[model samples]
Target: MRVISGTARGKRLQAPRGTDTRPITDMIKEALFNVLGSGIGGASLLDLFAGSGSVGIEALSRGARQVVFIDNSHNAVRVIRDNLNNCGFTQGFELYRNDVFRAVEILARRKTKFDYIYADPPFTVEAIFGPLLETLDRTSLLAPDGSLIIRSPRRMILPLKLKSLQEYRVNNYGESTLHYYRLI
Candidate 1:
């Protein structure tokens, strides 16, 4: 995969050699950035289930001030670091090899807030989706005006509203779907 725009435009990124992770497609990445537009600039991003860190890397390339990548796989973490170095993005990012829920709790304890938070959990593991959403709501991890974007199978149904957040947009990309949420 490659970065679609900004400082690292067209730079290639390496993914894990196995099927342990699913990377977002170029088309979907482009569309996501298009939807984000200038709002990404200078924003702080949190990338949960970061995989190869493609989504967070893209955000950094497009001028996000800071990005934190979280993933459970060791191979994924290594690949993300290599990709970051490849893109010459040595600063403004962090990588965490931990489960998403644990990462969330830790970040919350640290009082971290992100302007943009992105999540792409495994499609088959549907049980985590609701709890994840509720946890995000329970912790003030998302800025009041910030956004949380989730990628899931198109057929999967997620909550329309959380305690402090509400789904404002949903975009379908064939088999995958992007859900956008904001604080209510």
Candidate 2:
């Protein structure tokens, strides 16, 4: 994987060996950033099920102020760390090797807020979204106007409205789907 734009544009990133982690494709990443526009600069972001940290790294490369990456796999964590170091983003970010739900709870308890939140859990994990949305709804982890982007399989249908969040758009990229939600 590689960073698509900004300060660290074109820097190659390493992914964890095997099929355990799936990195976002360049085309989709570019399109996502295009939709994000100028909102990325100076924004704080959270990446859950971060995998190789490609998405968060891309955010940092595009001038985001800070990004928090969370993933439970040891290999994924190692790969993310190496990728961050290689991109010269040794600071301005935090990496957590823990369950995504647990990390989200801790961040919520700490009253952390992010301008953008991205979650790309394995497509087969069907039960995480509801609780995640509920937790986010009850906490201050999402800025009032911030957005949450979810990547899931095209076949699965996600909710359009969840308490404080409302679905704004859905984009299909091959077998994957991107769900864009914003706080009400």
Candidate 3:
């Protein structure tokens, strides 16, 4: 995988092998950042279920002030670390190897408030995502007026509405659907 734009444009990043990890295509990544525009600049991003740290690193490349990446797989964590180190991005990133659910719970407990929360859990695990993320909103884990961007396969059944938030846009690139949820 590679960073699609910004400071680290075209920089290569490793993706975990096997059938588990699916890196976002460069086209989709570019489109996502374009839609995000300058919103990424100086924003705090939390990449939950960070498979390859692709999205979070892209956010940083586009000038996001900081990013927190979470992934449970040892391979994913190692790749993220290597990618960050290669990009000289140590100062503004925190890589944590933890279960996505557990990390969410802990972050909520700690009152983490990020400007953007990107959730891209494995598509097959769709059933539990909505309720779990709704719980995050209920606990005020997301910052006021912040955005939650979710990438899921088109077949995944997820919520269209979340408290204080609304699904405003969806950009489809073949089998993947990138949903942009904003504060209402």
TM-score of each predicted structure versus truth: 0.98, 0.96, 0.93
Q: Where does candidate 2 stray beyond 4 Å?
A: none
lDDT of 3 by residue, 128-169 (tens): 578666865676656777888888888765667777777888
Instruction: Write down the TM-score for model 2.
Output: 0.96
Tens-digit lDDT string for candidate 1 (7-98): 99999988888876889999999999998899999999999999989999999999999999999999999999999999999899999999
Name the candidate that leads on lDDT.
Answer: 1
Task: List ranges where model 1 is wrong by over 4 Å.
Answer: none
**lDDT of each candidate versus the true structure:** 0.93, 0.90, 0.84
lDDT of 3: 0.84
Q: Indicate the TM-score of model 3.
A: 0.93
Cα RMSD for predicted model 1: 0.8
User: Model 3: residues >4 Å from true position, as ranges?
Assistant: none
What is candidate 2's lDDT per residue for 84-146, written digit by digit as tens?
Answer: 989999788999999988898899888899999999988666787677767766775889889
- How many angstroms is residue 66 displaced in model 2 relative to the true structure, after the best TM-score fit? 0.6
User: Which 10-residue window of candidate 1 scores lowest in summed lDDT?
Assistant: 122-131
